[model samples]
Target: MSTDFTDARLLDALGTLASTAGAAIMAHYGGASSIKSDGSPVTAADHAAEQVILAGLAGLLPEVPVLAEEAAAAGRWPASTRMLVAVDPLDGTREFISQNGEFTVNIGLIADGRPVAGVVFAPALSRLWLGAGSKAEAMELPPGAPISAATRRRTIRTRPLPAGGPVALVSRSHPDAATSAYYAGRGIGEQRPVGSSLKYTLIAEGEADVSARFASITEWDIAAAHAVLAAAGGEMTQPDGAPLVYGRAERQFRTDHFIACSGAYAAAGRR
Candidate 1:
């Protein structure tokens, strides 16, 4: 569990851990759910997946502290904060409860207030994405599949905005007026609604072009996918074009409104 491991090695470890956590979540996909004090839905799957991920992370990088959604909701915070792992065991619990295959398990490595490496695993979709540094990759793996060097993966990168316009992605469950207005004002007519952090990955893989969110979101919700997007030649920033960063303990790991887009779109002054 040396922290000196390379980003590629770290991504592989996280990919395996995320896939395992996804299986834990799938075990109770349709089970009962309850409301947390914050009014957000929580199910056994969330806890189960968190347990698996936390344990895996402990083994993978013992020195790095972990900040996870379920644990934080339960008032559990890691002691050390120099560098940490952000974990969202089940990112789209509503989607999971609704039996849609749009939820995901996210794990991101944070350093210097930015996500440097991370993994996003959608077990139901049999899709996985991971990135560290300039290398971002996506692959297919079943819910219970094990990851190794032999795992087949393809390099993924963001595509330049089309000559016509950039396709926009919005939250499938939390559409707001401000976001709609932002896109409409940009003359972005083609929009696709997606759940969870998948919107970031879509843009990362060149499947889409941009995502603008005026609504505030949590760190664990976007950190892993943010890393993937950055590594894939995309950028996430505030509406004023400031870099989106993580590990904001003062804000309880919450983030301000942000926009994510491909490098070309960003360079084109779309934000």
Candidate 2:
């Protein structure tokens, strides 16, 4: 298959699914009556969005396997030897349930344990970010604007994390107590919270220098962001100071603890 096909066609398909699902989510925002899943709230929007993503992916890339969040948790890990796609039909379920608007539709093309292309669309916020290979780039989309980037545009790059007072991005919902304590006990900088894998952009664009997470994350959630961050002069690695890699054959497919950083944070994993 042509890599270019994955670049434009796949990304476009993902953007559409995300946007459509986001609309479904917004329509159900703040409705009463509760049915929670795995201790987290589950709204009609979640299933609707997942179904849309799943159906679209199946139609677009009929050959490649799909590992979607909702399905994966329910024992639907794709079994493709060649390549497969990982989809977070909706990331940040809490944010979506809370109507806080940080949720996103994440889709990544994973081949031989690496992300070839990733599309993250926050429909409610009208932002679209896609990254390919080792180079990830992020862009914002005006609400109701065409998804194509031929019109308005901006680029992203990593700025060094402040020294002695480093700026950090922590999880908005699933905070890692150990990671937080590690930074605070080390007497480092201030921490900011955001939803999903959006923290990758902070270090990528120089807004924040370091983002550490010891809590569980899936490969689909970080693969595309990893590419973008790596391309923007940053690194994503395990807390043990190893570069992040994929294709592990775990049933759960949990990602190890990692830190994304510009300059100063590049070495934090070493300690």
Candidate 3:
């Protein structure tokens, strides 16, 4: 909670918390799911994982307020504050129900409308990523292993766009016609379809060069991975090229259209 905490320490805490939540989510994997009031599907895994993450965050940083998906959907939100945690215990619920192994547990810290730290854990894939400040890393979490015990962490960064072309990552669930038209107009290379915030992480890890979102989305959907991408030397901004700001009171945390890109792709957009 204190600014004095180094990025490494914050990421470590977040990784641990996210790993715990991932375990909770896996417990309900492959089970029946119910629809929430908003028409989005919800499973016991979502609630159970949220509970684990919330408790873990409270224990790790009691001073920091938490805004979690389940709680927020129930009309529960923390008071207006610059510094707080945003969590999506089960992102990609449809993927989970379909057993596609793309869902993730996301936890992020937002300060002054910017994501400063975050952790994204995909239990189904046993992959975890952490980011804070200007640093980011990826590691594998063996089945039932705690994140604190994860070894072989590799520092991650975005690669420059190739001379031939740039690869784009797009949403699997909500592909937009405008996004496709934008890519075509920009002469983008291959496009990859992925679920959840993993698209952002793929770009951060240099697996893809850019991601453009046009559909309706909430802060919790992207904040954590946005932090990781930013920390990995990538950038996320509005289509008009302004930096994305979080913690909107009027919009109830919804996000506008934005593009997340590596430096090379960002430069290409400028051109």
Winner by TM-score: 1
Instruction: Say which candidate scores most in lDDT.
Output: 1
For residue 269, model 1's alpha carbon misses the true position, in angstroms, by 0.6
**Candidate 2 residue-wise lDDT, 155-215, digit = tens:** 6667754655678788898876798787776545678888876777557767888788877
- Taking all chains together, each candidate's TM-score versus the true structure is 0.96, 0.84, 0.95
What is the lDDT of every predicted structure here?
A: 0.88, 0.69, 0.85
The parts of candidate 3 lying over 4 Å away from their true place are: 1-6
Model 2, residue 149: C-alpha shift (Å): 7.0
Model 1, position 87: C-alpha lDDT score: 92
- Which runs in model 2 stand beyond 4 Å of their true positions? 1-9, 32-37, 142-146, 149-151, 185-187, 267-271
Q: Which is the better candidate, 1 or 3, if ranked by TM-score?
A: 1
Better of 1 and 2 by lDDT: 1
Clashes of each: 0, 3, 0
Per-residue alpha-carbon lDDT of candidate 1 for residues 1-271, written as tens digits (9 for 90 to 100): 5675235776787788888888898889789999999999999999999999888877889888899999999898877656888899999888889988899999988887888888999989989999888988999888767776325689999997787789999888889999998998786849998999999998999999999999889899998999999999999999999888788887888998999999988998888
Of candidate 3, the 10-residue stretch with the lowest lDDT total is 1-10
Instruction: Compare candidates 2 and 3 on TM-score and give the better one.
Output: 3
lDDT ranking of the models: 1, 3, 2
lDDT of 3 by residue, 154-255 (tens): 999999887768888888887889898888877777888899999899889999898898776888888899999988999999989888889886788888
- lDDT, candidate 1, at 114: 89
